[model samples]
Target: MKLIRGLQNLQRAGIDSASGCVLTIGNFDGVHRGHQALLTRAVELAERYGVPATVLSFEPTPREYFSGERAPARVSNLCTKLLDLGSFGIGQVVLHRFGSAFAQLEATVFVRDVLASQLGVRAIVIGDDFRFGARRAGDLEMLRREGARLGFEVDGIASVCAEGLRCSSTALRDALAVPDLTHCEALLGRPYRLVGRVRGGLRLGRTLGMPTANVNLRRQPALRLGVYAVEARALNSDGTGGEFLPGVANLGVRPTLGLTRCLLETHLIDHSEDLYGRLLEVRFRQFLRPEQRFDDLSALSAQMQRDKSDAAAFFASKSTGPA
Candidate 1:
């Protein structure tokens, strides 16, 4: 997929920036089922207009930029979100950077300069809740009114829902907080998975006889801090395929060491190898126990062994889909 960095690239590439695409804009944080519906409509429109289908979303998301450290946990990082877009057959994305400067642009100027002149949008499909521009003044009415001037049309899709649950990034994050992986799969149309490159750890797990792959969670973890039943897999260089390993993962600060930083520490049940620098995918299956500081290393090690046993039992009782 082609990544449209910002307005400059969109301008330099001329009106063919995205081949005069039909587009939609949103954070699309998790590319959940609701997003899938929106993108599907965009694709259908693009095919009807004989132009490319494109997505315009923000980097650091508007929520991430404004909320800073207090920002909600991210269900899928940018890379994962892009992958989800590609899976839906979208080949271009307008990844606008949301910064102090960009946030100040007037509503019409943003549409005229970026959406119309730069990309030559054929149409814009957006959600009912979408808002944009300086102090968040933009809305669907503004888009349609400006569409008269810009020659593009606008369509708003009703949010998708399942089993009375509105499919949304917030709802997905909430499911993750409960660690209802099954519900996440329902909302997202897939299992909830965490993706990151494995990094070297303190080797303490090895000393405790449980070698672990440490993953740096790039944002506040959505799942509650706990021990969990998990299935860990390494992604190949081409970002496809890996050996599935039944495992247990701990997501929290290593409280025993007084480390305040949160981390994902996963130990494969029967496989041990150096995984530093490898891209790892961990699918959480069940919440095992809340994170806590033990009285001593002996206690902690013993608890880890039990966590492993629970993981094995969890796997035996349920398939990898979710617990």
Candidate 2:
């Protein structure tokens, strides 16, 4: 999928303003089931109109811009969000940086100048409760009126529900906070995953004989701080094709080591290979234990061994099937 960095680059990217496209706009944080429903409709409309299916989203998301430290923990970062969008058949993504000036844009101006004029959007698919523009004045009704006047179509999708719970980023975050992988899977229509590039660490895990692939996390994640049974895969430079390997992972701030920065450290079971700089996707399978500060390195190392054993057992059970 083509990624257009901003509105200023849309014309440079050669998108024909006259031809137009079917579009959906949102943060699309987790790209959960609800988002999938909207995207599916957008794709359908794109096919019918013979236009590209495009997604208009924001970087740093609006909440992150306005709320700062108080913003909700992200379910997926930009890299993961884009990967999910492409997997769901998105043809192009227009990622805008959210800042003070953009936040103050009026509702009418946003519809006319941004959506209609800049994007050449032929049709829009968004949630019924979506709000936009200066002080959040834009609503479905306003969007419909603008679409009518501007000669475009607007489709408002009701909230999608899964297992009687609304499939939303908020609900997905709640499930992750509980470390309930099953419910999260239902909400996302897939396992909740953390994706990042393997980076060099202080080699503490190596000293402990665990030798982990450390993935730096930029945004605070909604996932509970804990050790988990997981499966990981190293993607190619193009972000495709990798064989998943069973592993144990810790998603935490490393309080025992007095480190405050959050990190994802994974150790592949019975496997050893260099993973530095490769993009890795870690999928949580089962929560094992909450992160804790052990009294000493000995205790921490012992716990790490037990965590690995538990993860190995979990994978074994899955391979063996129900007794």
The lDDT values for all models are 0.84, 0.91
Q: How far does residue 14 in candidate 1 sit from its true spot (Å)?
A: 8.3
Pick the lDDT winner. 2
User: Which lDDT tens digits does candidate 1 get at residues 69-144?
Assistant: 8889888766567767877878688787889988899999989987887778998889887788999999989999
Query: Candidate 2: minimum summed lDDT over ten consecutive residues — where?
Result: 314-323
Model 1 collision count: 0
Off by over 4 Å in 1: 11-18, 49-51, 319-323
What C-alpha lDDT does candidate 2 achieve relative to the native structure? 0.91
**Candidate 1 deviation (Cα RMSD):** 2.6
Candidate 1 has a TM-score of 0.89
Q: Candidate 2: lDDT of 185?
A: 93
Candidate 1 clash pair list: none
What tens-digit string does per-residue lDDT give for candidate 2 at 1-323? Answer: 99999888988998856868999999998999999999999999999999999999997789989999888999877788888998888999999999898999999999999899988999999999999999999999999999999999999999999999988999989999997999999999899988898999999999999999999888669999999999998986556856789899999999999999999999999889999989998889999999999999999999999999999899888965211
**Where in model 2 is the C-alpha error above 4 Å?**
319-323
